[model samples]
Target chain A: MTLYERLGGEPAFQAAVDDFYRRMLTDERVSRFFDNVDMDGQIAKQKAFLTYVTGGPAAYTGKDMRKAHEHLWSKGLGDEHVDVVIEHLGATLIDLGAKAEDVAEVAELAESVRKDVLGR
Target chain B: MNPDRTARPAEPSSAIHLKGRTIPLAAGESVLEGLERAGIEAPSGCRAGTCCKCMLQGEDPPAMSQRSLRPTLRAQGFFLACQAYPIGTLELSSGEAPEPIDTVIQSVEAVAPDVARILLRPEDSFAFRPGQYLDVLHPSGALRSYSIASLPSDQVLELHVRRIANGLVSSWIHEQNEGQRVQIRGPFGQCFHVADDEQKRLLLVGAGTGLAPLLGIARDALEQGHKGSIKLVHGGLQPDRLYMRPQLSELAETWPNLEVEHCVLREATEQEHEGPLDQVAIRLAGSLENTRAFLCGDAEIVRLLQRSLFLAGISSAEMFADPFSPASP
Candidate 1:
């Protein structure tokens, strides 16, 4: 089956992301970043990101992530931040209801990219 | 606007709602037409099949192009944009490549400001060990790979998305149809599943949407109720730009063994610090013993983390990652 097919298409993905972030806000460890973030915008961007990447009708034709993030990186995006991002992602999948095998595959992918995301 | 009440679309595959960024391509039009339409200045050494520098991804797979891909690879779905014509909706990911890894888009959604959280699964069922990636099927047919954000054990899949201006997919996503469809495919590269489980602590790093895959790892660790302590470092711009905070906070709230530290590179109206990811790496120095690191996100940030980790005495084998960006042009 196609990846889209395997994911149960758009709804499944939407639900998964919703479940993913809902868990983030209350997590004492990483919720600080979202202390005053806009709730609706967060939902829209999250959904748009998923819709665009997963081949749903949506397209993420916004600013490049690097440059958009350049401002933040310039401020601070160290190994610690990256770790929090990764851990949250894992929890998201579980909440969104991903299989354990799928979750494991995601963790493995994160480790390989540490240098690029948090390295010099 | 009435939703679900709006008639369910018929022939979703054939009728694609054009976003503002779409380029109109006519017959005999080169695959480059879509690039030009999206205003992406693709780097093309040979617009023909020779140099292959122009080799960008197309709107969708089954898109045939020249160069970059061998016939066998093409048979598997890789294509050269310059040599190919526009088929349907063209997607360009990774400036050059075979389709990066074999993949097909699973779903799409816009969860927050300028961020689209995509949940993708590989099309080919090609085995990825974990912590690895398949190039994201960028609309212009570019192979932009992202780490698998969700873990293998988790039933659902996930990807973090923070918008990029002028970025074909990012911009289009920031402005368009909430339910539109896209095309993505892959399960490329390797992974970082720790078989030994000997390490007592797991360190994961992510910046912005880079946290997509790390969510997979932490969730799994928490599920097994593994005794190892999990420390996560997450960073982003202003609080409005904080992605995945809800989920991370909840986990930290409930789990005693998991600790996630949150930082911001951008305060509401001001920028601060050199870079949080690097900052985390600095603090992690010498404390790297018996810890496995999984990192993903924007390329520059990942590179910074990798170097720091190695210098901190973290073994190359113990560290794993999938760089999210590299300007090919």
Candidate 2:
């Protein structure tokens, strides 16, 4: 089995992300980040992203991390945002029923992107 | 030509065409150097041969300049599209290493606490066998490697990753968001799957993060209707250390051949068995019973299993193992 298969490919990850962002949209820690954002486009990008990140065959051809969140840096996003992202993502996994190791893999990925996502 | 002014000696030269420009490439110069010298962009990550982002296929298959390119991959036509320069007037194309792909891409999404999944979508017509890995790049230009967790058939590429404490790239992802981008290159490594070998009973063994590849193989098998006995042994230090129990349980319920077992060596510490994993090989001798086994985990565990299994009369040819680099390294 490949990583994509393990992550349950499109359907499973899509569910995870859908549940993930739904929680994130209202998340007090980072809800402001989603204020003006397009959930549809964000979801679309995230679907492609989570698919690729979880070992599926997709590519994320989007903005660079620094440029994407230079605004957040100016707004003072920190490890709190990182924690919020991870926490909500874990909840998303639970909602979608992602496995522990799978969630662990996601958590690892979260940590990898934390610095840039947090804009530190 | 300015020998006295240069600290390093220049080697032989080859001609290359990039973005419609031809430049002289030194014999030892990599495709990356060739492009860099010509002032054209060439994709690369983990120039160390471990990352497959610079993968290319053309008149000549790319060759890994370093032995780090896994053996199964080298047998297939993988070369560090970055490491190799044109030996001839080579037309070049590339896929991510481990697998295969084109272009460079990255966007951030937090998939789990401590795990922010960085998406590396490939360009059109990416080439890769299922189950290869890739290396992710950071704004600071550091490199971290990961595996493609998605099926090879999809247009987009996916990966599953875990965080290393204070890891350069992992830390970056956890803080990033939907539109945020980072450098991504690859589809490196050997395929963990063989085309639905129905005659071969399939046994998947994973330890800790090692389960990533096994997940890929199992999904491929189930989707294809491969009718082999599937038994997965995923052991952690303690039961709580195990992840994916629910998912595995669900899959087992659906597949008659699939049975998942969890083992714990101790209870207090979070560290899972990188495995003495020798126990797996011994366990396999009792259970493998002529089955083809796919093994992935720490190097020590993998090796220990191989030695024990071979002696236990399971033919060495029947065993497939993917060994990970040390955690501290």
Candidate 3:
């Protein structure tokens, strides 16, 4: 089974997304990117990101990620912000009861798009 | 764009009808591509469902097109035009800006020091959900958005206009007299009440004139025979900022399932609860499970309430928010 199914699939994601978003919003290191953004749209994108990282069925592509984050690149989106996101992703998965190894797997998956996210 | 309408069966052949124009779709062509082929300007990005910029309301849209949207939007027949591949004739709606409707001011009364309760009678058939907002056009081309406070049964549009200091559209609206005609466009916004589950608890929280939309949703839910416990929390900077107390109290008294609470930041009266608005709302709400929350008012405060409520256990899907961007003076 994929890590998504192992981690409880779609039913488990609603609360996970909420928890993950709260962490991101409260984290001072990365909160600036989120200010004044459309809440619903951001939430939807975050959910899609979660699904992508967790190996759930999503239509996320590298081209899409690069295009999505292009506007934020000028606002100082870089490796540090990507690292913070990875940290939060790991923490959110750990909080949701994923095994350490499973989290590493998700992190590796999330890391694959780092170049695209930074628009490199 | 009412989702409550009975859905029609999809036709065997595929075509898209938009704004009085019908464009036949090539086999396997997406709705966005078809619209573009017909020289129509439909907003789109990513050419995929991820961006959600190409959302359109339709009759029985393909299920795949709505998979990424929120439940409320999905219920409202909203789908991404980029991802839709309708097998039958699809009628897209509200793509173009609606023409302004001429309405006569029926009455205007001051509900608070800076707020006016303006009632208007539209000369045209304006079909809109209660909590949606419409743009009131000023004579000089300036316009402002106000939430509808009255239900369809009232046969008139009720708007609560908070007069911003030196605000162009607001100042003009406050000075208008009865019998004066005004132009209005759109009944837009998705923050209205939906009777998905009758037993689900409802929380309506707003600050300042944000109370307008919450009041509309509360009454709409009650009118729809919702059996759920409904809580309406209205907050302000001080006691005087809270308006329409007697009407709210009368509503709560008439409906046993309804509860009304007034909150203020400072100078609380004996009848009012004094504290931070978000804290007060979460405290009074008690349990958050199976609860649907509607939050409105200042953009910053709405964001705070949305985050707090989501962390406190309400699902993101169940929370509907209408954050008003501050008007530049």
Candidate 4:
């Protein structure tokens, strides 16, 4: 089974997505990127990102990731911002009762997209 | 296990009706796949139901397709195309305006400095929830939306319209007479109260004329005998902007479970609390657990309230909103 299914699929991801988004919105380190954004639309994007990192079926491509973050580059998005997201992904999974090994795997998967997300 | 052969008749195969074309669904094929097979470009993402990007409205769609959406969206016939497996032919919602209904103005009274309470009686039978909004079609073809402030049992449609400085539709509505005829359509929106849990506390916050839908919802809940506490906080630029104080005060007196509070940004009267709306509302809400919030008024302030309340502990699913944006010329 894919890690997505092993970790409880859609319902489990629903719970994790809200927690993950709350953390990002509340965290001063990365909250600036979300100003003037619609809450529902941002939540949907977060859910898609969570699905991609957890090895679920996602329509996102590396090119899409680069384009999505392209505008944020001028606002000082870089490796540090990517690291903050990765850290939050791991923390969210751990809080949701994910095994340590699974959280590590998810973090590794998230890191693989760092270059694309930061337009490196 | 014995297979039942004579207990039930064979059901009809499922098909999709879209834009005057009928497309049959192959066995095990989803509605999205069927649309794609028929050379139609349907918006979709993450073909698995998690993304919720392929939502479409349908008549009597499968319950399973709407499971992940909120109750209000589901009630509006929205379903995820990727998850739908309709057991019967389903008619899709084309992006066309519904037919307008003719109504006669029953009354029009100025409730505040710029707000008018206009009542209308539809010539034909009309069905709508109290908090849902409808479009008023101006004689010049401009359309504007207003939320229903009166329950259906009142036998008339009530709207609280705040006249914008140079708004065409609002100006026309404010100048209408009691016997005048008007055209309206819709009853759109998903901001009404659902009677799912009688014991769930309701926190309704509105600014300026946003009190229309909240008043409808509060009345609907109380009429349904909601046992949980309901707190309504109405805010404005100043105390003069807050209308219907006497009516709301009498309502609070009638229902022990309902408590009404008025707030303003400045010039606090003895009866009004003064501060930023979001801060005042969060402080008055006290405990946020098990609370469902209905936020209304301008888009920016509604967004602020939504984020603040969500952060204060209300679940995203428990919050409904109607954020009005200015009608573009």
- The most accurate candidate by lDDT is 4
Candidate 1, residues A1-120, lDDT tens digits: the string is 433336665556645555545556556565555543444345445554443333344333334333324445554666777676567766765665556776566666555555554433
Error of 4 at A32 (Å): 1.7
Q: Best TM-score goes to which candidate?
A: 4
Place model 4 in a CAPRI quality band: medium
lDDT of 3: 0.89
lDDT of 2 by residue, A5-33 (tens): 76555546645665666566556778777
Quote the positional error of residue B301 for candidate 4 in Å: 0.7
lDDT per residue (tens digit) for residues B96-145 in model 3: 68899999999999999999999999999999888899999988887889
lDDT value, residue B253 of candidate 4:
100
Best by DockQ: 4
Better of 1 and 4 by lDDT: 4
TM-score of each: 0.44, 0.47, 0.85, 0.91
Docking class of 3: acceptable
lDDT of each: 0.56, 0.61, 0.89, 0.89
State the lDDT of candidate 4 residue by residue for B1-329, as single tens digits.
44687666565498999888888898899999999999988899888887787999989899999988888888778999999988879899995767899999999999999999999999877788888999999999999999998898988999999999989999999999989999999878899988889999999999988999999999999998999999999999999999999999999999999999999999999999999898899999899889999999999899999888878878777889889888988
lDDT of 2 by residue, B28-71 (tens): 88777777777776677545343456665555544434233434
| C-alpha RMSD values across all candidates | 22.2, 21.8, 6.1, 4.0
* Positional deviation of residue B2's Cα in model 4 after best superposition, in angstroms: 31
Single out the weakest 10-residue window by summed lDDT for candidate 1 chain A: A59-68
DockQ of each: 0.02, 0.01, 0.33, 0.63
Each candidate's chain A: what TM-score?
0.61, 0.80, 0.96, 0.94
Q: Which 10 residues in a row give candidate 1 chain B its minimum summed lDDT?
A: B10-19
Candidate 1 local Cα displacement, residue A57, angstroms: 55
